[model samples]
Target chain A: MIQVGVNGYGTIGKRVADAVAAQPDMVLRGVAKRSPNHEAESAVKREYDLYAADPDRTDEFEAVGLPPAGTLSDLLADVDVVVDCCPAGVGAQNRDIYDAHDVRVVFQGGEDATVADASFTARTAFETARDADAVRVVSCNSTGLARLLAPVAESFGVETARVTLIRRGGDPAQTDRGPINDIVPDPVGLPSHHGPDVNTVLPGVDVDTAALKAPVTAMHTHSVNVTLETTPTADEVRRLLADESRLFLIPEGAGIDGAGALKEYAMDLGRPRGDLWENCLWGESVHVSGRDLYLFQNVHQEADVVPENVDAIRAMATDTAAAESMATTDQALGVGLESRLDTDTELPDSITADD
Target chain B: MIQVGVNGYGTIGKRVADAVAAQPDMVLRGVAKRSPNHEAESAVKREYDLYAADPDRTDEFEAVGLPPAGTLSDLLADVDVVVDCCPAGVGAQNRDIYDAHDVRVVFQGGEDATVADASFTARTAFETARDADAVRVVSCNSTGLARLLAPVAESFGVETARVTLIRRGGDPAQTDRGPINDIVPDPVGLPSHHGPDVNTVLPGVDVDTAALKAPVTAMHTHSVNVTLETTPTADEVRRLLADESRLFLIPEGAGIDGAGALKEYAMDLGRPRGDLWENCLWGESVHVSGRDLYLFQNVHQEADVVPENVDAIRAMATDTAAAESMATTDQALGVGLESRLDTDTELPDSITADD
Candidate 1:
């Protein structure tokens, strides 16, 4: 079994550690954190070996009744692969250490593309990172876009894709982040960084993106429109998207109108941390007019990338094929089987050119 | 002077009555209310005539120590123009009463376009309603779109316009409305009714729109993208939008990033009811890439349509030219003069084709 160490036990780090632990092919070696806090205590309670990320904070860890299993260097030396969940720029800072240890590394999306040999999402570019030393999983928005566009480009041939990302202001625990009572054009720039980020995995796909932040903490909603080279009925497009394991086509009869109801549904199903690992696309929103296709999808910022990180680690350390690796990760983590609604609820007839 | 009666004295009604009272060329005949409440008492305190909209509820008004001047019919017969500010669909119900009285009527955007003889926004199609029996002022979002596009279409010539409206869940006083912690694909349909609404005034302009609802109560923010017939530098477009009296180009240094800050700025300026009567477009957001133009603008739902109603009144009752009537309305109600910051703060050099 491949041993994995998670660096930085924060929002994403803790979740990635839990995901790695669940994977049957891998074992979670430990998690590294700079300070001793509630998360550290919880990590210890869950029987995870907690390493001190900062050598200077080792004493503080023991003083807080959470003794360190080892230093970050010791953990790095022991593990076969490390998932660097350090905050955005810090991953680049940790690169030299990872290189010296000569271990495979998986970087989260927050790091710049240059920090990794390849940018990856399992469905789109898993082979690009096959047996590579390090790979970066693109951000939630980019992952959602790449996962969506890959199939569209393959089937209908995308000519131009334009999207407006209506982003949540913060995750539930980010109390200080804001626009609490407002909507703001985040970056207020044309073709925000998300478009170029999507190109990292799926090159030659022409996509333009704009983003705004609203007073919400649930999930990011994307309003997507794509001009295709060939026309397809909305029903055909819906069937195509439904084939993807990561895309959850929300049904109308479920009455899951928005993120709140979606979360409530997930909690009602007793999902761990009420996580939704799939892209929740409103099934009824799938529409086609001539060459134009439009729909909206919700990306859970906290959880969408967790599965990608798991698949990325496998791509770097194993010779497993992309589809097989993805299937293994999906089954091990219960990635796509969350729907309890009657998805067979009749949708309106496809909007087509004849209409 | 044109005598104006306001029916449905709720959020928009009270504001319109005050605006009419402020206009030198108009008189507030009275306001109509269905039942007695604090608003009725406040109207009485302001010494304005109050009419009971529901004849059966006249006793309810008298029971609360608020006496009605007469029924809604009396107010409708006395005024030269009546502004219908009832809730959505209620305006359609009130249409027969105004028609029976043979009075000129200005209906709010809530009513269907078929309810009026002409759809109106002062800047775009003022003359469409010149001396007409009735006209409808478009909604706040449409008014903002028209006001921004009129100058743009005049200067650059719009080929196609696409907008994604990030709508506030409800006005501040609307406690019953929600998606309180979620973002919803309101309608989840392509080319929402907003595109058609804009066509009601600025016909022949190709526009497609989509909208979402966020957990905000401050204002609606729009992500606007237009393909212009000719390319222009971002600076030129910024200057063009800045010249429009009703467009408040927010400067970068002023630190107004979103609706919350914009509303706070207005309240700090002591604007009545913290109303932003202008479209708050972030000047720095004005961007041009080849033939495509992009920007973001905020529309105050409670206030943007107020000035339109005032101008629609003149459009339906008098022969004033569009420019003169808009100027008069602007001057009397202080429409365009709210900046306290040094708008002269130099912006970054334009992002142009050559850049």
Candidate 2:
């Protein structure tokens, strides 16, 4: 089994650590935390070896009754690969430490593209990271965009794409960040960085994006409009997207109105942490006007990337094919099946009394 | 001077009555109310001849120390034209009343396009309603879309348009309507009626629309992406849009992030009731990738149609040209100047010490 070490046990790290532990082909060696906080204690309680991310804070962990397995360097030495989940710029700073230990590294989307050997999204470019030393998974938004566009690009040639992201102000736990009672055009400038970042994985697929922050914490919603080389009926496109394992086509009769209902549905399904690993796209919102396609999808910022992290770990450490690896990750994590079963029952009955 | 009567003294009726009173060539003959309420009292205090909309409620007006001048039929007989500002279906029911009086009529967007002789937006298809017996202004969202697309269609031929409307749950006073903590894919259906609505004013313009309701009361924000037949630079399109009097291209230096700030800016400018008569589009969000044009604009539902109602009145009652009528309405009601004066002073000084 490939041994895995997760560094930085915050919002993303803790989820990654749990996902790593769940994968049958991988063994969770440990998780690193800088401070001896509740997450560290939770990590220890879950039987994950807790390592002190900061060498200076090693003694602090022991003082808080949560003694470290060792320093981050010690944990890195033991594991075959490490998933660095530190906040944005901090991952770039930790690159040297990862290089010194000579372990395969998986970096989150926050770092610049130059920090890794290749930018990664499993469905888009899994082979690019195969047996590579390091690869960066694109941001949640980029992953969501690339996953939906990949099949469209393959079926009907993509001429151009324009997207407007109605983003959540913050995660549920983040209280300080806001536009609490407002909608702010983040960057308020032409072509937000999302387009360029998407290019890292998608190469030459033309995309321009603008984003605004709304007073929401559930998920980020994307209003996507793409021009295709050939026109496809809305039903044909809907069927094509439904075939994607990572895209959840929300049905009409389910009565799931918004992110609030989506979250409630996930919780009701007994999903761990109420996570949504797939893009929750409204099935009815899919439409075609001539050669243009329009739809809206909600991307759960916290959980969409968890399965990707698992797939990335396999891409670097194992010689498994992309499709097989993706299947393993989806099945082991219960990605798409639960949502289908629930929404299937909620669908309307076609054969009524009159029929 | 042309005498105008306003029926239904509510959110829109009161505003239309005031706008009519401010016009250089029009006179507010009276306003009709169904019952004696605070709004009726306010209208009487402002010296507007208050008439009872429901003949049964005429005695109720005097019972509350607010006597009505006459019934709605009496006010209709006195005025040369009447602006129907009642709720959605009520205006359609009142179509026969206007026909009976033989007076020209202007209907708000809530009424269907068939309720009048022609659908109207001052910037688009003004001639279609010229000297007609009746005209209906398109909805606020349609007005904003038609106004912005008219110039774009004129300068660069529009091939197709896709828009996503981030709609407010309700107007400020509408406490009963909501998706208060949710982002609902309103209608959750393919091609929401907005695209078809725009076609009323701007026929044969290939457009598709999707909408979601956010927990906001300030305004509706639209993410517009249009494909043009000819390629134009972003600056060229910006310059073209800037020339349109009704489109307020919000400058970069002004820190108006979202609808809340836009409202605050409007109130600060001392606009009547903080009404944004112009489409407040972010100047910097104008972007061009190949032949595609993208921008974001906020539409104030309460007031964007007020000026359109005025122009519709002119279209049906006078021989004034579209441009001349729009300019008169803008000048008398102060449509676009206040925003410019305030943002001009807030702009950054480029000629600094380094220069």
Candidate 3:
């Protein structure tokens, strides 16, 4: 069995640990926590072997009734692959440590693009993760854009892609962020850096991205406009998006208009924490004028990348093909099994349980 | 004072009555309802002179503990302009009645493009509403697109405009209608007829619009993609949008993301029914790639056209100029006063009370 260790226990880290536990072919070696905080307690509650990133902070865990399993060096030596969920820029700092241990690694989106040989977002360019010593999963926004753009790019050659990201202020747990009653331009110069992040995963497409952080923290909604090389009918575009398993095309009449009802639908389906793992696209909103395709979709900022990280793990450690790995990931996590999981369905034809 | 009568006390009529009441130069003559329903009772509570559209149903108001209102003919005789808020096709029937009384009329979007002399969306084409015998206000969706596009068209000519309308199933009070769980393609045709509605107002620009109805009632979100005649940077486009009084540019870090939080912001500011009179545009979402301009903004279906109706009243009945009429309407309604209305403002500079 493949052994995996998580180096951080924050938003993405805790989820990575749980996802590793769900994998049939993987055994979670352990997880590393910087402080003996509430999250450290959670790591222990899941029966994960806990290690302290700093040797001096090991006692912090012991004082909180949870003994540390080992030091970060020791954890690195034991696990075949260490999924680095450390804070931004810290991944680059830990690059030397990971190389010293000669352990394979997977980094989150927050890390700079250079930390990994190539940025990873499955389905869009899953093969890019293959045989790489280090891989970084693209940010939630990039993952969403890749997932959406890949299908279109494949169906019709894209000449130019433009996206406006309506971002949430912070994760639901992040209470320290501000601008509670105003909208400001973040990194307000030119094209946002998100386009380059998306390019790391999908380089062939010429893309421009702009973003705004809103006060609410539910999910990020993307307004995508793609100018394609070929002109397809609106129906053709709708069907193309509906075919992708990772894309949940919200059907009309389904009362699921925006992110609020989409979240409510997930909770109604008994999803853990009402998390919608798939990119929620309003199918009826997909329209094609001339060669341009326009649509609005919501990406659950915290949860979307969870499945992508799992796929990246298999891509790195195993010789699994991109399609096969994605299929296995989807089946294991129940990613595209909306019809079977949903007890109450408003649309007879809809395929996702997240509604 | 310009006297206006509203025929049909449904979603659009009640708001029109309230807006007319708030206008400095306008007085609401009365509102006509077919039956003494809950909405009609609301009209009475607001002190609007309620009239019965159906002469046979005059007793319905008295039976519901509400006093009788004059007949439709009597209401038409009193008001200089009759804003027809009747259902689809019903406005066409009422057209003859309005003409016989020699009173000017304003029709809602539900009526076809040919229902009036010309469809009007103030600011986009306030001149079209000028001294007309009859005028129909473009849809909430049209109003939003016109408001966003007019600036772009004026500054940089618009080659093409493509929009995808994520429409609400009904008004907040409308609970009986919906797909309940699906997103279906409404009017499953080429353009969904919204483009034609836009054309009736802005004839020079080539626009393509598609629409789908979601089970939401709060508001309709529009995904707009416009290819400009000249290529401008993202910064120039953003500054242009921010200058429009009718457009509220939701900046980055303001934390107001989705329709839910937007509604919350409105409620917090103590607006009646959490109504946002202006189009809520995510400022940071405005981006330019080559010549393409992309944006995402929401149109509050119930309240967006309320201010427009008042402007149309001034345009048709009074000798008020377009700019003057819009300014008077904006001030009386307490619009452009976000900073003042909001006790807790993240934006230190905004003066509008209705953020």
Candidate 4:
């Protein structure tokens, strides 16, 4: 079994730990906590070997009515991979921790793209992590764009891709993230840094992105406009998208609602995470009129990226077959990739990379 | 045969003319044009009586664009009803033209609610024009909210309805509306006026609306979240919605896109107006999770209000039975009501108010 350790236990971290527990080939070696607070106590109850880093603060958990756990150094000794689900600015500091222990570390979406030597969004940048010891997952917006753009680019040569991201007010944990009641033009400019950020993973794609933050928490909706080198009918485009496993194409006559269908369809598909994993596609929603086509899809900001980290880890395990493994995983998990059905129901060892 | 006159030969005016001409009970009396411009010439070539409204003026088209064939006074003499497809602010000025000619005129949605004594939207305010000789149609956003909200409210007792309107950027005439590159907030406030505006038609419902304008054309997409007065299953709500005739419920398993299916569904239905005479509900898109239901629906701003204008005219033609006729037309049109069959059949008497 592959030994996996998590270095943070916040909202996304807890989910990553839960996901690791669900995988058949993975085992939780241990987890690191920032403070011996209430969250740390809760983690301990879940059979997680919680640990702290500061040597001077040995019994912080006891002072907070918590059980005693080992130090971070002791936990780091045995784990093969440590996922740094730490807070945004702080992940850069923890890079030294991974280097000292000589173990691979995975960073969350919040960590800046510059934090890691390589960024991992599964669709765009998983290959970059093949030789690196640490990998940072792209932000939710970048991940979503990568997923949608990859298939469209592959199917039709992309001349230009433009997107407007309608983001929610805040994550449940992001108390400090801004104008809560009003819709603010985030970045307030064209070609938002998202295009460039996504390029870190997908180097050659020329894309422009814009963003807005609305006062709701359901999910982020993207209005994407792709100018293809060759135009395809709406039906043809729908067929391409519907062929993907992670993408759920909503039928036109069904009168399905947007994110509502997205969450439900994801849940109904029996995804491991509830409405948190997978992307929802409205099949008939993609409209090709003249040279233009329109579509509506939803991106669950937190859960979609969790699996990308998993895929990036596997890609780093070997270089010779990294591209093929990454492509296979994207086919399995990325939205809008055509599903390939073979005579054999199960993938062989040649295709499966142990992360 | 009822003689229906269109005063403008613009995009909506031409469609209105076509819709009226298709009906057996209606006769296309003639179309008025301010100038013999290319579009007006096209309307004339279609064998519509093309009369220059203002021979004395050079830019006759601008002055008489909405209801295109002739001067308001000229159309009043022969036509029983006149559709003021005129530009915004011009509708109010032409109100006297309808009054002097002693002809009932139907105004487009551009004019505010205060444009006429009564406003007609398929959603809430259709009844307000029951006895009035002249009426206004509510904007596209109100029309969409009314259709979705009425069903959800009646079945689940919606505590509050909050909606975010993703409006297409350009006017129908503007060609660049497609391939939207940016998403902008309508304004920086909660409870946008769109929800309040809907109350005029709905009477006693409370809704909060926020709008964002994106650079795409075709239709407006709304992301709505409703807090129910009582909890219910998503399937129950979807069933309740699917029962509505004017609403073509997009099915679940079939992959469908939004406006693309809606427009095609309307066309296939042979709807007299081509698009829906009422709002199009997204059936498969609706999802319910623990009393919280989500979905997205499309509202054609220009074409949807056309039929309501017809209904309002039918009411004015017989004032003693105005309320009765309004109710009849509302039921027939399935406004503020639900009908089950997903049949694509057009009403026999479906025509513009000019008829």
**In model 4, what is the error at residue A302, expressed in angstroms?**
1.3
Model 4 misses residue A203 by how many Å?
2.0
Tell me how candidate 1 scores on lDDT.
0.81
Query: In model 1, how large is the Cα lDDT of residue A101?
Result: 94
Lowest lDDT sum, 10 consecutive residues, model 2 chain B, at: B346-355
Q: After superposition, how far is residue A322 of candidate 3 from its true place, in Å?
A: 68
Which has the better TM-score: candidate 1, or candidate 4? 1
lDDT of 2 by residue, B35-123 (tens): 56445656775789999988987876776567789999999999999998887768888888889999999887877778888899988
Please give the distance, in angstroms, between residue A58's alpha carbon in candidate 3 and its true position after superposition: 32
Query: TM-score for all predictions?
Result: 0.51, 0.50, 0.50, 0.46
Give me the displacement of residue B160 in model 1, in angstroms: 67
Candidate 1 clash total? 0
Instruction: Score residue B186 of candidate 1 by CA lDDT.
Output: 80
Error of 3 at B19 (Å): 0.7
lDDT of 3 by residue, B1-355 (tens): 9988989876677678878988888888898887654345456656789888888877655655666668999999998999988876788899999999999999888777788888888887788877689888888888888888888999999999999898887654344568555677887897878887777787788899888888665678989899999999988987787788888876553446567556645643446656688999877678888999998999888778888888998998877888899899989886652321211112211100000
Pick the winner on lDDT between candidates 1 and 3: 1
Against the native complex, each candidate's DockQ, computed on alpha carbons, is: 0.01, 0.01, 0.01, 0.01
Residue-level lDDT tens digits of model 3 in A209-297: 88887765668889999999999998898788878888887755444656655764554343555567899987778888999999999
Q: Write the per-residue lDDT of candidate 1 for residues A1-355, one digit (tens) a residue.
A: 9999999876678788889999989999999987664456557767999998889879867765678999999999999899998877788899999999998898888888999999999998989888689999999889999989999999999999999999988765444578767889987979799999999998999999999999776689999999999999999998899899999888654546678656644543435666788899998899999999999999888788889999998888888888898888888878884333433322111110000
